[model samples]
Target: MTNPTSPRRHLPTSPFRTAAPPPAKRFAVGDRVSHDEFGLGRAISVEGDGTIAVLVDFGSRQERITAPFAKLFLL
Candidate 1:
């Protein structure tokens, strides 16, 4: 059980979970990527620091996806 105040609690007894969270995902212009729902596409442009949102060209249509990018993945 956990609360909104602290979603993840790290214990000293656990060695594996002690490491910091994974680094943020980064995408460059023209970087090929795939989305769970958007099929496949190339990154058209990156908004802000590239972590806030990403504009992707998914063939038939373009969509703006924001973080945390749960479905977005680099190809």
Candidate 2:
């Protein structure tokens, strides 16, 4: 039995809890990248010391993805 007033603890293997956010992804100009929804692209411009946003050219369009990019990955 557990104390009703006690704060619940997160299990080490708990899938519902996130121990830590994934590391921030960094990109540089001319880098190749793939996006979950945008397909393959090439980095055109980077801003804010590579911590703010990255401008990428996806051939058909360009996107400005902000920091902590979840769907963007370097190739």
Candidate 3:
């Protein structure tokens, strides 16, 4: 049974409505960069027509991180 005084339920939230931070644009392909967290790396690839993939060497290991060019600065 439903009560006439009961409050109405709200609709479920949508996940697609959320906004993402603008992509950074700093380096180009074949450019060198240094990250505070990743140390030193070189730009290997750019995808999504904006983001860049960096290959970093941390002495003991090498890793790759995709970030907007804006987040990285020219060295």
Q: What is the C-alpha lDDT of each candidate?
A: 0.90, 0.89, 0.59
**Whose TM-score is greatest here?**
1
Native-to-model Cα distance after best TM-score fit, residue 20 in candidate 1, in Å = 1.0
Kindly list the per-residue Cα lDDT of model 1 for residues 30-52, writing each as its tens digit: 99999999899999999877888
Q: What is the per-residue lDDT of model 2 for residues 4-49, given as tens digits with 9 covering 90 to 100? A: 9996788889889656756667789999999999999999999986
Q: Where is model 2 poorest over a 10-residue stretch in terms of lDDT?
A: 17-26
Which stretches of candidate 1 lie above 4 Å from their native place? Answer: 1-8, 11-17
My TM-score estimates for the predictions, one after another, are: 0.75, 0.69, 0.41
Query: What lDDT tens digits, residue by residue, belong to model 3 across residues 1-75?
Result: 899899755455844444565656644567777777666666665555435565545456666666653345557
| Candidate 2: Cα lDDT at 41 | 99
Error of 3 at 58 (Å): 5.6
